[model samples]
Target: MTEPLHSGEVDRAEYDVERGKIREFARATFTTDPVHTDRNAAQAAGFTEVPATLTHTVVAGHQREQRKFVEMLGLALERVVVGSVKWTYLRPLSAGDHVVGTRRIVDDVQREGKRGGSMRVVTLETEYVDADGDPVVRLEEVLIERGEQR
Candidate 1:
């Protein structure tokens, strides 16, 4: 078992939204909301362009943050388990908006388990901002058993 892990900051990554990508995500998620797939419908809904759902933003930016966090830990990918995820949307994300995401380690704890033996819980908070520098979303991802407990 390795030593207890410490928290660290991870660099951000920017993603440029593409219409085709939005449409594909909408289709795969079985989202029938016109605002997510049709530009006209979105504008009619008071948005400048097709607006992506909050869940869609996970793939757009948060996923990249998760990958970078894991890589920074120098731990094997297979050893990490995403225990939970929660997010808050500050503003709508449109199909053509560019977003940058930054992540910070919020907490880390070690506990002795009854069956899983020793375990560690790591929490990370990520913020996403649009091209205009406005906050778009905030996400919290909890990675459990990411490394050795001892």
Candidate 2:
């Protein structure tokens, strides 16, 4: 059985946006935009530094934090199903930026399954802020934990 769910922060971590990492990610993701890898090019393009691709947050170690979050909640990883994922970009995050991500449990609900078991839906939100505490990005993930068979 899973522990009771609560709506609050679960984890927080600081992520350093390094230039080499941004370049590597840009190459790996086939981001042809020079602004993502070349500082001079980025500067010419009116950016202060190399900017990361929009989906670069996927590699920011949030998955490990989420796994720990599930474990802390006493939920079995095998029984959990991803419902949906959403990302909202508030501002651009560039190399040389130190961003802090705070993860929270925003919603939890119990629902009756069509079959015969109960289901638990949990929504987790992670907010990223720059060094000056300005919002940079927001990520929300919905997970559903299935109950045991009848």
Candidate 3:
């Protein structure tokens, strides 16, 4: 890598949750929770509509944003591996809730390895805020690049 990426907003996106996606996620994850699939059940649980589980937010963010900072840093996706994904959720997001998110470069480091090779560890943090501008969740992830860099 030319230089270690600095902390800053690297990408952004907006997402609108749909009930079907939550239902599919609930089923795929074997949640078996009525609140995830049943709109009425979710509303009864205090959400205006079916809410996405904590896991769904990360999935939805990736799908909807369709981006990453490694790519922006001119790194290859095939060489990147997820080291960790830490989440901090402030409030549950409901279906029909429009959320805006920013993908930020929290840190990046390059280290020398054996056999005269080097690797880069890129840290990213994404924060999602609802249309109400309330913070929803913060996803802190570390992506490590392997193999040789061009």
Q: Count of backbone clashes for each model?
A: 0, 0, 0
- Model 1, position 122: C-alpha lDDT score: 78
The whole-model C-alpha lDDT of candidate 1 against the native structure comes to 0.77
Error of 3 at 91 (Å): 0.7
Every model's Cα RMSD, please? Answer: 3.6, 3.2, 3.3
Give TM per candidate.
Answer: 0.82, 0.84, 0.81
Model 2 stretches with alpha carbons more than 4 Å out: 1-4, 62-67, 114-116
Candidate 1 contains a number of clashing pairs equal to 0
lDDT of each: 0.77, 0.83, 0.79
> Taking the tens digit of each residue's C-alpha lDDT, what string does model 2 give over 36-123?
8778999999998888888777766743566777788777788899999899999787888898888888888778889879998888
Question: Candidate 3: RMSD over Cα atoms?
Answer: 3.3
After superposition, the stretches of candidate 1 with alpha carbons farther than 4 Å from their true spots are 1-4, 60-68, 114-116, 146-150
In angstroms, the error of model 3 at 81 is 0.5
Q: Model 1 over residues 100-128: C-alpha lDDT tens digits?
A: 88887777777766666766777788788
Flag the better candidate by TM-score, 1 or 2: 2
Which pairs of residues have clashing backbones in candidate 2?
A: none
Best by TM-score: 2
Evaluate residue 129 in candidate 1 and report its C-alpha lDDT on the 0 to 100 scale.
Answer: 91
lDDT winner, 1 or 2 = 2
